[model samples]
Target: MQHILNRMIVQSMETDRSWFEGDLMERFLRYVRVHTTSDPHSASTPSTERQFDLARMLETELRSLGSTDVTLDEQCRLIARVPATGPGDPIGFMAHVDTAPDFPGEHVNPCVHERYDGGVIELGGGFTLDPAEYPMLSRYTGETVITTDGSTLLGADDKAGIAEIMTAVAYLTAHPQIHHPEIEVIFTSDEETGRGMDGFPVEKLRSGFCFTIDGTDEGAVEAECFTAYKATVSFTGYSIHPGSARGKLANATSMAATYIAMLPRSESPEATDDRYGFYCATEVTGGISKASATIILRDFDHDIVKRRISYLEQLARTIEGSFPGGKVDVNVDRQYLNMADFLAPHPEVLDRVRKAIAATGMEPVIHRIRGGTDGARLCERGIPTPNIFTGGQNLHGRYEWIALPAMVRASKTIVNLVQLFAG
Candidate 1:
């Protein structure tokens, strides 16, 4: 019976050999297993030392693949150059290596659901993914999908992106006669922490434009994304004994609550979508003596984003004015700018992606990312980077998953994109 099962496995492999091309699935599995979660609170370059494990592994793999000019810097950014054959414009591909801190990114045990039937799927640890909640699962019928064991996130958010980019690198290397440009591939660190591109050696890149393989949905070509900022609103107040508090005490936490109360419910993330900007309070903490809240502002329009920041600053002042002994301080920092601002002038950049997606028999989706990627920062640095899909869904969570066939199409899209740049 065991021999019969082995023969069946061999037969399946023979029938679906194309699905395993470039070892995309195998690479993704290996990458997700590594604990590379980035810390948003850390002041370090990678935000976590564990990220270097994957960085070193990728460096070694690139060396073994005969890739040249490979380097892993102090910031944990890994870059590898694929020499051009029959020269054309240099192009680049990027993907982040660190998993999100939104959930447990350690001990990622990926489970393969072969030939999914578009139904509720069981993930261990008392978690089950329902098609009713995640409609995207319905689209993967008849395709192999990967999910976690419900203990931790699947890490498809960027690991899958890394796998797809590596597949492209491997393909372009073996098929040197494919007529391509000098390809620069980078694996970024701490993208989930929202500061991955900080100190990234963008000056070293030869590509005038690049694509970040950090998007969701199959065949997605993203040029628009949120212009992001993180704001910390801290409050200070005088504390007194309860008997004397009535007239002498200024409660800092109450001041914070007042500021939060002033935030418009209609203008929040839960209430907005598709080009609508939002102010989301991610963290709130303190006692009567001290209090603070972390809020993120996001919008597509530069003017609107500025207005939102102004609103935050004004609100802080108003909150302070309400209490004579209370002080409120708002500090806003730019996270990333929208990529469309840089990519719009390059219609040819978008056109090439559409053609490549079409070449893989999938219609290209001109998408707007509600969040940002490493591409946004690269674009800001004059690289004009856009985003491409990795066929991931429910990203940054335990319910995350990806379609095997979708990844194959994406891999094919990258191959075709490289050729399209040849002219």
Candidate 2:
């Protein structure tokens, strides 16, 4: 039945000039329903076993798409090699299968609009997707826009990316006459938790450059991202009965709250945009006896990142001093560095992205990622990967949406990027 539905969809798409558009749309809808939300606290490679669901599905799909050397490793990275028609080293395209844990990722019911009317869209749960609130939707008017039902995230953060890659792979297999070099297609897991590239085997890639299809908006190209750090502050206190509590009992929860309170509201994720960096408190948990808080510090400048780290360390000491009997510990873990330095030598990497977007008839908008992508670590590891757009909006939330036409353009951009690499 599923195969029949797939064939029907493809057959319907055959009527369209860009046959891959229907495939990209269906692929995204199917992938998001698989429940691949990742866990941040998990020590495992994928951070969640369920991510294997999409990985396994893509592995089989890639083989069926005429892709060679397809492999889904234990770490939940599904890689496939598209044999070269001409001759050159393979260039890679990547996206993540895992959805963000910030919102409900399971049982996603997407609302597909054939042609938006440029009015308010009533997503359920009293959440209305108003064009006034999101000016980006104005551009999507009169287009096929996919959105959440207001119950779960649309998961277009990277599913749209996955769909674009899959559609491009399908396009390549269908059109062998279009000259191109060898292509590597990679889909990763746990990207939402910022550990997608953990122990990434750089040796696996034969590509001199890779493009991550994980950006938002149309014609977006990103070559840089914030240097990220994971800082955990642990608070320790004495657990005592309320009858004997008084001043003798030191409250760890209070200490954690105090530390959080010390964070500047003006220097938070909600407070900043573009190249400006900030500290984000992701998680806080504990009782009076023990507790811990997880905060992510990000800056485009390494020196600023260093200063942020130092500030956090000093803040921990201050909290300890205030608690007296309570204990505070701050552990800062380097996540990924700014990819700009690593990619500085390769101007063509970004140049080709511009050319590709231009070939798709859109003006490429170059920007910096306020957050990081799997390509960030890959860039630092010598692949010199940059990111291209996936047509996503309001990512990681129930209000998330995407324009189907934009993703189709992105797929063509990938095809163009592949050909440019051959040249």
Candidate 3:
């Protein structure tokens, strides 16, 4: 079985040079055109009704590609099975269907630049992606680059992952002699809003482990992620007319501003990198009578995250004392935890991924994810899932872009992984 898998890798390498035939890029372009931005405020499974549009389309595509047991659940998660030709543990591949709510994800007009000249790309509306700012652009000097028209986010965050997974599954289906084991492909919704795996049917997947194709750069394989929590601080103040506001009136907005100002400037998203954690204020809105601020706290250390939450509660009390008549409320909710905790017992899962990545002629770049992925939640549920990149950069914004050749490499890596697992 190992010998057969080795020969298969060699053949796949030769065919991968032109395997896509433009299908990968076409699928990505088509996906970004649909508006599937998730809403954080919604309590529904998908968090957005429009996510089904893409889910249904992917279901149709999966069935047409000869997939079996395809199912689109009520949560808008699309799962399918590619039949096996050999005996091995079934492998699972996942990617999200929804875009982030940080930026506009509607009417995305993607621009494809073939044989990029390694120069500054001017994406209209006075937005230009300067290579000097993002040196990674030079790596794909003569390759095909895809970007947004500067009006909306490109949705490459996970859509690029989706396209790569689809392309890999299609390639396997076309070549019946690949000798891979049964493969499970899943497309989840509301990943951006952090509820991606809330409705996931883990028992039904039946795979020993899974990999989430949702990261940046081609060689990255994320095994560690931050423990995440969301904190909401509400301030209630007494309102009075301006003429009598001297001592009786307490402004809620002013109290909220004070709390924000008290946050450590050194412990912010812009001030940290790598494994460093930070507290980020995502939203703040208020008037004279009532105001609320939503903050996202993250750290790789579970204890540190708890300390951060405690600090927030203490700060809220201090603010309440400063304003005699004002009341401050702090609420914290756990989002997800570091996958490393769950993955530690299953080092073989990451080892296999590294070997597969190296088989594609690229060094595996193992790194810790500062932000959470669906793998974090899935791993907590005993799936031992990790993240793989999709050749995307500047995700969740208009400057987001992807390299077609890099994406091809990612797809090739996926194919190699399947063969390795099956062997």
Instruction: Give the lowest summed-lDDT range of ten residues in model 3.
Output: 1-10
lDDT of 1 at 335: 87
In the range 1-423, model 3's lDDT, one tens digit per residue, is 452347655565667676573879889999999999999999988899999999999999999999999999999988999999777889899999999999999999999999999999999999999999999999999989999999999999889999999999998898777778899999999988877888578888878889999899878999999999999999999999979788888899999999998988889999998777999998999999999999999999999889999999999999988987999999998888899998898787787788777877788988997888888898878788899989999999999999998888788888888887776
Give candidate 2 regions above 4 Å deviation.
Answer: 1-16, 41-43, 122-127, 233-273, 279-295, 311-330
- Number of clashing pairs per prediction, in order: 0, 0, 0
Which of the two candidates, 1 or 2, achieves a greater TM-score against the reference?
1
- Candidate number that wins on TM-score, 2 or 3: 3
Question: Per-residue lDDT for 248 in model 2?
Answer: 74
Assess every candidate by TM-score. 0.87, 0.83, 0.85
Candidate 1 lDDT, tens digit per residue, 1-423?
Answer: 011112332344335447554389889999999999999999989899999999999999998878889999999999998887756888999998899999998989999998898889999978999999998888888878899999999999899889988887787677666667788889989998878888888889989889999888897888999999999999999988878787678899999998988988999999998889999999999998999999999999989989989999999889878887999889999988999999888988898888778767788889888988888888888999988998999988988998888787777677778877874
Off by over 4 Å in 1: 1-22, 117-120, 130-135, 236-251, 286-290
Per-residue error (Å), model 2, residue 280: 4.8
True lDDT of residue 422, candidate 2:
68
Error of 1 at 200 (Å): 1.3
